[model samples]
Target chain A: MDFSLTDDQRMMQESLSRTLAEASSLDRVRKFAADPADRGADVWAALTDFGLPGIVIGEEYGGLGLTLLDAALMAEALGRAVTPVPYLGAVLAPLALRLAGSVEQQARWLPKLASGQVTAAVAISEAVAGARDGAGLMASDGKLSGKALFVADGHAADLLIVADTGGVLHLVDGTANGLGREIMTGIDLTRRMAELTFDKVAAEPLTGDAGALARLRDAGWVLLAADTLGACDVMIEKAVAYAKERKQFGRVIGSFQAVKHLCAEMAAELEPCRSLVWYAGYAFDAAPQESSLVAAHAKAHLSEVSRFIARTATEVHGGMGITDLLGLHFWFKRVGLNRQLLGGPERVRALAAQMQGLTG
Target chain B: MDLRLSPDMEAFRDQVRGFLGQHKDRYASGAGAERPREAAMEWQALLIDNGYAARTIPKAYGGYGAEPDILKSRIIAEEFTAAGAPRGFANQGISMLVPTLLEVGSEEQKIRWISPTLRGETVWCQGYSEPGAGSDLANLQTKGVEDGEDFLISGQKIWTSTAAQADMIFCLVRTEPQAPKHDGISYILFPMTTPGIEVRPLKTMTGSAEFNEVFFTDVRVPQSAVVGGRGRGWFVANATLKHERGMLGDPNATEARFAALIDLMKSETVDGQRLIDNPVMADRLMQLQARVMTMKFNGLRTLTASITGEAAGLAGMVVKLQGCELNHQIAALAIDALGELGVLYEDGPHLRAKGGWQRNYMFDLGLIIGGGTAQIQKNIISERGLGMPREPKLAVA
Candidate 1:
């Protein structure tokens, strides 16, 4: 019943906050941007060594088995830094696998994911071309063929969790026969993306049915929401601080009513997003049955708000903000990426409305 | 951080609900009646006698002295409002004036006022707004000159709600006119029945004389009646207004109104379709429902912060403005729900649903203007909440 974070959780927040603050420094992110392959290995190991990927993984799988709140705290830290790590691909992908994969699949992947030895991506989207009235790709006969657009960190991942029209998850090797991966140029360069082509890719079925895959996708959306919430938190702090430090009309610009109002609005927008994300996290932790609705609520709310806060953060920073003089842009891009990632705001909202019986 | 109530609190809620249920029909008629003050007072006394009143009042005073876990009291307040009991009018006296007195008044003041206030012995009305001092309240010209051991007050107050029924008035008077606009003031408590004091009723659009124009002509009150230090009236008024902004706009009123609207929509039909089944009405309801949810969340965040001793400095302004705006929107929405009857204020052949929509629509107009103008709240949001610069004031007259 307690809404307050525990001391352990607070420490987790602080530790993550500090780690990202230093590691995701403007210099660090700039260096990574300059050499994309020089990826955030140090930060990655530090987070994993701290048992981040295993946050929701059961202890039986050599993981911490903490709640999504813990996962959220970790995501918030990543968001604060706009750090370049495939946490969604690294953590959520494996968590999804553990949730929906068969015993044999879990045995093959869970330990590697827990130990940070491998990364994975979930492929669910398909291009809407040559479509019928109710067009969707079928996943019968085990072999897989279809292109999953905007596969996050697809090129870097070791495994791929693919879902088809049957709502079932098919686990396939990243470089399996008939599987193709193409890196795409994206606006938020801090986050990489890939187009995954599966030409009847060799695959192994996971779990008994696709029902678990649906659950996993919803959980993934919540995590994506958690990630965006984290990014928004960072943007608010950055904008507020910038407002205080940057001056206009012979006073600190933060002293101006317009800037103050903007920051306040951002703070307002961020708090609810945080609360919604936490509620989703709590639901995931306590009530698995209601997770989908909460996740939709969180994702829909966070996507719009995080995007707003990011834009406001940049606008509040003025010209200095445009060049990445401060570390603000990193968090800004992270939020922008999150808004479009895992389905845009409109899609998420439509899904949420449907879930609420509003669409029906 | 937990928003959930304890078992004890839940039990307390049930007990309160049961008591309210028992007496619901007895006090159902009045919307804002003035004469039968005793009916309301007697209800307060009953609540106090049964330990159901002043849930947050300190025990040292005549209250149960419960440590204020305000959410519980808020829940109780909501139940009372939902039950349509005018018995909760003493809320301002208990929730606002009493707390102010406790904070700034002497021990003697608390002894003299807090207990009886809960018992509904002393009704209070706020006297901060003046004809020329609506949003710019500090420019108030109500004067209280020092005369021997007392202050001779001569001034006028506008938009004073419930003044006709009030036993006393908490006023913001100009004490040091030569000082700066904000610094030259004092917060005083004066009896409304005293000599040279007048309360002229101002009829509202709702057909009720709920507000007033009060005049004070050399009304002498002892210096002991000042709630806080002289020339500190601005701070005192701000504190009281802060309480109003933070706690006054209970979601209970709107929530009850919304629930009723939904029920009516369900039972009624337009063009042979249930009102709730119509997309236009359903979408509107969904949006309002979303707003209500956000307001609830905002209340929780503010309440949690207050409990943790980190008050949200200007977010209160945002809450107040949102409450008023949403209330007005909901009223309009209700009118749309009422269809043709919305235009009729009386029970006529053309009227429907007892003409409640027209009454509500008119009543909501006063809500935004009375507590603080919506524009003033926006100013607060800009200057204080947003740290925006104050607009240059016109030269003082």
Candidate 2:
């Protein structure tokens, strides 16, 4: 028995890592983050050329028909580069549709979603914090009447799949009547978030069973966890690199055991995340029974570990770590945001406990 | 990649399971650590008879000579570990000496030592750490002066665990005192009963006399006693360290410890509420649980690389450092969860989980320090694992 990635998967990983390393490096990410309207169009175009958005879409829908794990790899690279792209909303929203959308809905939307012709945003949170069990938006007669706060890439979407108070989904067009958006300024400017208000906006209802919303939530957790994994990877790598080059008291910082131990401790905490996110993503596709528990585990554990790594990584950079010049804060802020995105450690572990039957 | 074993491997697993199912009750009475040498050897012989002992040894050496299939080996480890049957002697013989011998021993040495060691006829211990040379092992002062057809060795080795039980000690002695430190050391072997040898048992901080200070007052061994060539002790010792690293933290055993933790949380109560029901406790447990799974997958990745003949490189070092830390954390977490009972030892009936948590906490300290200290591990990782610049050596004068 082997748990290593397939050759194809490894090739995909290497190619994406190389491209992001080249095109969406932190310098480029800073350039994009400075432009309020910029969502890394050049890097997005490169990824579109690589057909990343469609990696998990069905073959019949003009996509690669790979698994959620394949898409999670892209998420990791994007997170590592801190690239400004609406991957979860634009790429993964299609999978949500494919999971719960009607046959005609799939026939019409899947190809367009896979081809990058249409972009979608996911509106799953209502408060500054996340909505519980996908229950927040209220819907009646194919019209969404409540708010979906913190909508990812909400302002740029051509379509939006909205989760409501009953943990059901409602699909709305971007140009639909009576819909308004107040763009929110988040610490992580690379990825955009907005407060979307649906004033009886016209939307089409999808098949929104409890199982469907749970899968969407699980997918959300896995994607965010994968992104955090990526952030931790780069933060540790960058910190270690800085330790070797930066000097203090006539010795390189790494020569000091304190700095060396800090770097080593970061590795110890972050290395486990590689496999945690991997198996979580794998469970999303191949082992459905293991998906939720592992996803919760990944999210909760990485939420805390990535935060520690982020703070320690910044500390490794010393005083310059907090400044905008070195751009180390990009990774630090990315991890900070990802730590609280869907559910932080406390919330996620509560869900995990319920799943394990440890709590009533 | 798929985690399903092939049918052949599956059948092999079943064979091991069925065999253990039949004989599990015999010799399962003794804890593996407490099993006497003869009883342990008898169990080892039974397992050897069933083609499980010396799993990687060649069939020419009365072993099954199984191919280097990682899963089958894991299966043997899992079953033998579960059935309470001793896998190998609780000493340095199986894990360290056997592997190093296969790599560099003479064919005669193999014939004379390999089978008997596998059959548990000989118990081996290591004599590497001395009182003054614990972490800086290369600075050992043990000397071996060449005599007529023999080397007269005079040295004292400290903290030699299992020395009382070991039939032979695989040790290092400085053969050329005037040469550079690492260059003068040589790996040698001799029986514990040799003249001028003395073993004084020392109780460890954990309150066990599991270690000793072994002194040799001009003990003699023939020139052929060196395992590898003379003045190659450091290199051979590193080889043994590799095997020790691989064997130190078995992830499956960590998984079992976690399971026991969950069981304790399920049964134990704090302030009339079950421990698992506490949010802080549950969160901590969940985090450690995730780390355990990651450790398992990392292990699988290592196994896959070995099976597919890829260069695992410093992956072994990564596993060693991370594995020990994980084991240590798991033990520490258990002790923390035990609350008041954490203060007690395993001798008391009132202690939680029979005070296994405290006992394991003591054991994890050895794992962290043995093979190499955590600081030494970081040195290796920074120098070799990450290609960072090595620390500049100070003037030795």
Candidate 3:
């Protein structure tokens, strides 16, 4: 009946957090956010050195062979630092391949993806779920066309795992002919997004069934929820620290009920999310039947709660919150972007209702 | 992160199921009927005898006296809730006062109070809040002047639930006027029939008098009635209040209510479409579903912390705040889903769920404010959990 992280999981999270703290300080994050040429090469290298990219990859494929729960913890660490890195795709691409890719395909790419020798981007949002702005991808006659928007870490990827209009996942080469990548500048500079234009570009389809796609979506939701949980934690911490030190009316602002309540509300809202995300991650591997529904719950709930924390934390910082010096907006924007990524709360709830047979 | 129970626990669950299967019908006949006091006492005694209730208290105290096992306790609760079996006695006496007495009461007090409380023979009501000491309870002015072996009590206690039916009252009184507010209090227990004690029902917005205001004018209790110690009542009361908060924020109750809500949504319709099929209502239901899941999982995490002896900290502190608010919201949403039928109470010919949702919506609001106001909870979370500074003391006038 144990429902807590194992000691090893805790140690792993602590180690990753320490590495991220040293590698992606606020100054480094700010500098990386401002520089167009910087692709967070250093931060990615630190994560790779820490074996994070391979945490969930198969041990047979030059990786640690950990579970999704471990990867979610790593995502949380990256979120706390708002580290400028390509982690979403690094984890999700391998997961999609592992879940649906052919044996030969897994043998070819798993080792490279696991060792950080190659970087991959995932483009599932437009075609599989939450399609918006007339954006989608289609595959026919061994060729891919149309556009996939909001491709996480698309710019520097050597490989792309994309879902087509029929919900079939395919592997595409980054430098394939007629494949065009246009970077979309989102408010959250910590992670980059791109719109990939596919004009009859060649793509090899994965052989798995629709269940694999659903699993990928569930994994994506859990990871995103974990990331939001991490970001909210940092925002609350920053707000509480600022309140303790910042003074108004001849005393520290934390002594005031209003400021204290703001911090308290944020904590109250976010503390539950930690367990929620952990349970979702645990369900991903240990409780397969409930995986999809729990994932949706985690995603939808955190999407709403993180927004509150982000806003309230920013308000706690007073005018300094808006200033670039505090870099509070990084977390705030990160939370904002997370709410809409991979489907917002409304769509996620709709999916949950449908899953429960509550809606047609 | 395994959630599966052990084989031993599973066997224990089956044992519980079998026990309930055999004995539940004894009390099932009285469901929805007015209080069947004798039958309830018999059922409580059966539970205590079977280790289904008072499982952790000592044998001398007339409990089952099993070793403390959180998982077994959880299993008992789940099985009882599932089978609709009577879960023995659960009142302020058993839930809050019994635990406090076990922790700090004298052997005489334990032998005298714990056994009867567990057996449903003794009903108790809390006497912490007064009109002046609702949130800032240390400011209580209920004086207990020492006179020989007894303390002469005089004060008013407000919002005392079950005061009318309670046979005993555990109270807080100011025993020392010159001492600091937090240090001048005493926790005393006495029979509700004590001379000069008055209980007047205070009708709530729910249109029922489940709570009351009790006046104590020269009500006398022996010095032995003071549990924990005389000037340490504040600390003892805090301990009991912790249990009170836990009781009010029970995830099991919320889960059951949520399940009932789903049933209502599925059974009720508007404009020839089921309410569950309505997109707006479905979305709202899913939102509540998320919160319900949060409460359940967070509860599991806290239980794990307890079993492992780890500090739950903020996770434990936020339960009452989140649970109470979420329960209120759930009831509010249920009413919204009820549509035109929502306004119908027990008297209406077309009343829904026997007007339970309407009653709960109003009662849950009281819950949020009663154990600790949401504002006070926030203060505690910020001050203790987050290590935020306390509000500075204002200069005394």
| Clash counts for the predictions, in order | 12, 2, 0
Considering only chain B, report the TM-score of each candidate against the true chain B. 0.87, 0.93, 0.97
Per-residue lDDT over A1-360 for candidate 1, one digit per residue giving the tens place of the 0 to 100 score:
255567788898888777677767767777876675765678678777777767777788888878776777677677767677777766666666667677777877888888877777766654211222343345657788766667777767888876666666778887688877777767666667777777777788776654666566676677788878777776777777777777667678876656776776676556545555666776775777777777766766677777778888888988877875676777777777777776675666555555666445
Cα-based lDDT at residue B336, candidate 2: 74
Expressed as tens digits, the lDDT of each residue in B330-356 for candidate 3 is 999999999889979866679988888
Write the residue-wise lDDT of candidate 1 on B1-397 in tens digits.
Answer: 3446789878888987898888765553222535336666676656655555766677677777676776666667767766766544445666579878877888998888888777766777889899999878899999999999999999999988879888888899998989999999999987889999988999877787778999999999988888789899899878877677655455666677777777777777778887766666765665565455556555665666676777655444567666766777787887887677567877677776677777767776777766776666655665665555564445969
The whole-model C-alpha lDDT of candidate 2 against the native structure comes to 0.79
Interface RMSD for each of the candidates: 4.2, 1.8, 0.6
CAPRI-style grade of the A/B interface in model 1: acceptable
Per-residue lDDT, model 2, residue A13, is 81
lDDT of 1: 0.72
Scanning candidate 2 chain A in windows of ten residues, the lowest lDDT window is A126-135
Listed models, DockQ each: 0.24, 0.64, 0.90
By lDDT, the candidates rank as 3, 2, 1
TM-scores for candidates 1 onward, in order:
0.85, 0.95, 0.98
Judging by TM-score, tell me the better candidate of 1 and 3: 3
Instruction: Give lDDT tens digits, candidate 3, residues A1-360.
Output: 998999999999999899988899999998888886788888888888999878888899989999988889888988898988888888888888888888999999999988888899889887545678888887889999999998888988999999888888999988899999988999998888899999999999987666777888898899889999999999999999999999999999999999999999999999988999999999999999999999999999999999899889989999998898888999999988888888989999999999888788
| Reference A-B contact fraction recovered by candidate 2 | 0.60
Clashes of 1: 12
- Clash pairs detected, candidate 3: none
